[model samples]
Target: MPVPRPFPPRPFHGWRVVQAAFVLAIFAWGIGFYGVGLYIQTLSASRAWPVAWLSAAVTFHFLVSAGLVALLPDWHRRFGIAAVTRAGALASALGLLGWGWAPHPWLLAPAAALTGVGWALCSGAAINAMLMPWFDRRRPAALAMAYNGASIGGIAMTPFWAWLIAGWGFGAATAVVAALLLAVVWPLAGLVLGRSPAEFGQHADGEAAARPPPAVAPAAARDRAALLRDARFIGLSAAFAIGLFAQMGLVTHLVSLLAPVLGVQGAGFAVSLVTVFALLGRTVTGWLLPQGEKRRLAAAATFVTQVAGSLALLLGGDQAWLLLLGCALFGIGVGNLLSLPPLIVQAEFPPAEVGRVVALMQAINQALYALAPLGFGLMRDVGSTAAAIGLALALQVLAGILVLRRPAP
Candidate 1:
């Protein structure tokens, strides 16, 4: 009796759901998001299409996804997450094929639209919705863990796509990757996403029994319409949108900016380093995030770090070590920007309204980020690299200010 040891607790099924969401994010971000630049380059080279025309298609792809993502909550409510996810996989597969097969410039419109539809259903909002039913208290950590897949997707897929295109040509590469996406995501959607916490005789966070949902303040909004009008909602959405606008613009131009200083191979490595730092940053923030107002402050601080990084890059100029340092600083905030918004929504809104709020926020961010590349590129063309970086840095500063302006009770 004196030497007795306690039994180990069983693994929580919610963690398994996290794992599934993680895998889903990998493909969603890989093919739909990170692969866009490669698509532009390949289509440009092989089809002899104008880069400007292809870039517009890329912009349209993001805009379409933005519109569709706003409706994601409603779609999931009506059709169910698993079914919607399966449809997304199918759409994504077809879209990838369409990218390679489209013979005319105008054809890219339908191809971009198809990929946009797929991306809307498979990306951030979808991942958040997938995990919402399973974890309440642990939501931050779960999302942080799952969102890392996006970074992993970028790190793994960019080079992989380039290699595939190099070896097999665009058509064969697209077919193979599309096939792999369908094979993995279709079964995954059915297997893991089909079940809920209740199905496994569990409550959120794998609790022993049911507990009351988190308390909402008397002034808290209850429905999507009310949430849309809420000051907090507006503030949160604006801050994230502005921050992401900067992040997306900077990232889209980062390789080109660094190439002048670090050379081609070094520039590519820097971008990969940014993804690595993003993974590390998001993981740390998610695990250590405090509740309530402090969370907003933490989010604001991330923007501040990015601002400093941008400034460093601008001032660092042709100095490789200083430029690399700036990249590290900027990279630290990249994943946090994506992961923190949902956490903010969770903290400010009631459990019932979380899905819609998150969806709307993501929609807003995407709409702005859709324009980021063009906006930044224009700045570079009209002025200089410093001007583009300056524009991003200014927006990030504004984002930090906006986020800290929590609505008064």
Candidate 2:
């Protein structure tokens, strides 16, 4: 019999760090962060509550995260990656465990809320911050691929989760999800992850293992006051907030909103398919960003496509194929959302505060995301799809113009 090779020594440089980090971000966020959307319908169906009511749990998650992001840097400093990540994993497990057997909306809401809270801690505090200390040059692509894990995980698991929910029920599915969190993520967080590249005998910028991290320029390191006063970052944040509002709004009511088109048989199937397209968007954007400064091009293309797709629903209606196409377009636009703000922060803010900057941005992003679904639900409550789409398109155009005027951050 062939002998197994010994385990590779811990990588000090090159792509291994990036690879490990990316894989970890995927399971850490996708299954943890975006996977909540998959259960909205199941909750609504079982409870007979309005989609708005049940999906509000997602908004609550966002709210909690927004409130907590300011503390992320402090948390990282105090606990390190392994501790923070493991805590997140454990929170996820407990949350999922809570969700699995939740007998009513009261029980499920808290469970889902816990999962979202855990995600905020793990995703923002642990993953995003840790990446900065690893490599500077390939950071954009690495961050892109890592966050893309959300779409990838959602795509891969949503369908199966749907099947499980359909065949077995929420309790068993929650158990499986709990197992995935506890067995895989909890261990990964504690065993292999580190707080900063320095722990691995390397600089944050990924030069020779022995080189210390480059000292930050006084200018880059001292931009905090400027960041708050800066119109550019504020505008950029607003622009992102507008788009996120629409996207989160859609996710909040996706199953109910499109149920007419997808029908009962295809609801779960359609969501998974849309998420697959989102995965494609993430992969493509991560690849294209390396060769050129095409952030503007990406933003423009996505805006135009989203405009057309949202209008298509008004004009032609959401046939299965058309709806899928719209989902793809939405995903295409959203891929930029995953990376652009982080990239912008790296550019505009001091490198040392990258973690702080993201915390701020994420707070803004999540707060707006939390408010959107209810706002849209209220809009849809009183009007037709055409009216809602019209408003969204108009808002999107405003955001597009605002963002494109300056180029993506």
Which stretches in model 2 have alpha-carbon errors above 4 Å?
Answer: 1-14, 28-34, 47-53, 107-110, 203-206, 209-216, 219-226, 257-259, 262-270, 290-297, 318-323, 405-409
Kindly provide the TM-score of model 2 when superposed on the true structure, using C-alpha atoms.
Answer: 0.84
Clashing pairs in 1: none
Error of 2 at 313 (Å): 3.1
Q: What does candidate 2's lDDT look like per residue over 1-409, in tens digits?
A: 9999998656565355455556666665555556666567666778665676666666676677678766777777887767776777777778887766666667766776677767777774456676777756666777766766666667666666778788988878878877776786666565556545555666655565445555854544334466566676677778878877877776556667678877855765666666666666767766666433356556656667667666665564756777766666766666677676776566555577778777777778778878877787788879966677677777777777777665333
Badly placed stretches (over 4 Å) of model 1 are 1-10, 213-224
In candidate 1, residue 335 scores what lDDT? 94
The C-alpha RMSD in Å for every predicted model, in order, reads 2.9, 4.7
User: Which tens-of-lDDT digit does each residue in 1-409 have in candidate 1?
Assistant: 5988888655678888889899988899998889999999899888899999999999999999999998898899899999999999999899999998887989989999999999999999999999999888888999999999999999998888989999999989999999999898898888898678767778889989888644754445366677678998898899999999999999999999999889999999999989999999999998999987789999999999999899999999789988988899899999999899999888877667788889988988999999999999999999999999999999999999999998863
Clashes of each: 0, 1
